[model samples]
Target: MEVKVTSSTILPSPTSHHSDIPLTIFDRFAANIHIYVIYAFTPPTPSNADLISALSKTLVYFPTLTANLSTDCHGRPCVSVGGPHEDRGALVVEATVLSKLEDHLPLTPSPDLRLLHPDAENPKHLLQVQLNRFQCGGLVIGLTSHHRVADGRSMCAFTIAWGKILRGVPIDPLPFYDQPWLKPRNPPLVQFDHWGSEFIHLSPQSNEFIITRTDVDPSEITNLLLHFSPDFITKLKAQTNKLSTDKHTTFETLLGYLWRKMTIARQLDDEECTTLSVSVNGRRRLQPTVPPEFFGNLVLNAYPKAKAKALIEGGAATAAGIVREGLRFIGEDYFQSFIDFGEVYGDRDLVPCFEKDGNVLSPKIEVDGWLGLGFDEVNFGGGGKLCAFLPTWVPFEGLLIFSPSLSQSGGVDVFVSLLEKHAVTMREISHSLD
Candidate 1:
């Protein structure tokens, strides 16, 4: 299959926002990262011109995404909103793919799949989109948004708004972009001891704490899309609750189950410390809860650790309990303390260390839950609902994303990326779930 780039253009915001908006602590960390979301639709694809037109109008409310990324005198990242003639706009590309849309179903990370979205590292455009028209008359909408400007929820807001505009419908729960809502205390105080360990920052002792991009050979890794129907989730939840007196949430049960299975598959040392890092949305967890429509990064990582032997032997209940305990650390006070911690140490370069070589450096896994994100309802005019949704392959091993499946069958899709050998075992574990 071949993809040909047909046209490239810029779509500026319909209305001007602030001249310069300073990024929050959460935004600074993901300054160089870009989040990709691909949506596939059936034939009689929506008009590229119509989609672009709708996007232009949608930018009026989400102008921050159209702004260019810049650093202030303090060397901190900021969004620079340009004037009428400053050429501040998103990069829009139209391409033609010679393969059928179904051919790429359950997408994986590869050079071919990479062609679906804009360059991940490109800083010139805060938002980039690729409109791919397949030979089978199917449409694939690829979106790449700077992670510093918005989190997954924020991105969903943008797409939902664009879809509303295309369908000539009113957008509800309008977006809010004020950053002062999360301002740090006058005298920043650190309340959390584990903040330093979870976030990567500049250390006086060494530069190793700074996060950097690493490449992995696709052949050495395996990416799988596993589905868990609602029935299966209910059964798993029952099993977990039966093991422990406490009732386990579906998220905790699923995460615990996967962690246990992955550990067993890897066959790690019994005494080795294994950690699972779960992403927590802090929007509603904060004091005076942030607005549902607030656009930006409001997430924190919850790390739950246990010995491999204990985790495997304790079964799903123990693992799920550990996860529940980890989540307890993220509350109103914790989020406020985190913001203060960032203010005091915002200048430092904090990075996350992941396994680069074939060997596992640390026994760690990151699970990002994308459930209840409304990814399937994004319609781009003409009643075109998202048929499939998945992130292109990420090189990071042991990173799992739980997303809502597009089939609307009350199921969940677990996108797992692991070592080739471990992936083989994961497939077997998933098959056994049936």
Candidate 2:
């Protein structure tokens, strides 16, 4: 499993914004950490030179991708685009592996998978990419982006746009950057308990994972990839909606089932409460809803909690209801209040409140749903399209991602990190409907 680094270069955008793009409050609310996306393509993919050239041209439409992250003299974070300190660009690393791609058909999350992507520690550039070429001509494109610059949807848009440009196709929905619309209203109307829900009196502990930043070691985390077949998804949905006619979505039912499984695997006490932090996008929930194509972060978490006894004893129907109820709590008013909160207190540094009941080893799990984001449309031509897409590695405990599987069968792929012992137990019971 040796990967030889052939070249490392900083590729700048051919065009620049020539201005400092101040991050919106939504951006500020998102984690300030680097997240990776890996796309494995079968042999007959485009050459590195052609792909890189296409990327350079694509960055012209996304100046924020080429920009460096910095702060204003007032100390608020901002993206410096073609400024006095503007040599910054996306980092591209090229490497080659001696083995054939067939050895790793369905890639899973593991510590060794970290080598497939650029190192994220103290990253200089906001966006980074790695090209891992196999002897079989198969290519795995690993991309990383600082969460503040964009969200998962934005990254998908950028990747899809890059692929389209490589194939000489027009970008259907051009990237939009009308940020002033997100500004807090004049004489900002503050309406929610944001300080209690979003901000903390103490400084952040580490990079945000869902909502909890902890001192947990990466070595203790166990990463697993569980694929749910379409048939299995249908079964889970039936079980989730059996007790009620709420008609929970695939995301809700799936997440509800997972929360129950993990909770049972953890073997918590009957009275103990477990909170699941679900990522909710404020784009369509806003007053005059933000465009789905808006390229920035609008993600906030919805906290769904139930006693471990209730989640395990009450069945999938109860769990799905809890999940839906929590998500419904964060509506247009919820988003507007967050915006108003940012307007009033954004200048002063604010930390996210990690825990509610002061539980140290908090019983919280985080999840993000990445279905229907147009991942299937990312095709670089040359007889190669997306064979698979997944996270390089999940290093934190109690975090999960529900992604649409790129397999021909069309199912769901669940990538998760948990305690080693719990992960082992969860794996044994992952597919069991009981």
TM-score against truth, every candidate: 0.91, 0.93
Q: Clash totals for all models, in order? A: 9, 0
Candidate 1 regions exceeding 4 Å error are 15-18, 84-88, 106-111, 120-123, 200-203, 206-218, 347-362, 431-434
Tens digits of lDDT, candidate 1, 1-434: 58889999988765554477777777764435677768888877679999999998999888888887777677766787766544368889999998888887655545467687766545367798999998877898888887878888889888989999988898887898876657899898788863345564445755655434444565676667888998888888888898898998888888888888888777789999888878889887987888879988888778899999999889889989999999887888888887897788777655533312232323778788988877777888665546778886666577789988776576888888788888788788863542
After superposition, the stretches of candidate 2 with alpha carbons farther than 4 Å from their true spots are 15-17, 84-87, 202-214, 354-362
| Model 1 TM-score, 2 decimals | 0.91
lDDT of 2 by residue, 1-434 (tens): 67888998888755544677778877877776789878889979999999888888898888788787788777887888874444478889999988887788878876666677777555778888899998979998888888888998888899999998999999878989886556777788888777656776444653332354355566777888999999998998987787888898888888888999999888889999999888898887887878877898888889999999989988888999999999999998888878888888888776656532221233788788888877767889989657888888766778789888888898999998888878889999889896
lDDT of each: 0.78, 0.81
- Lowest summed lDDT across 10 adjacent residues in model 2 is found at 353-362
Q: Report the number of the highest-TM-score candidate.
A: 2
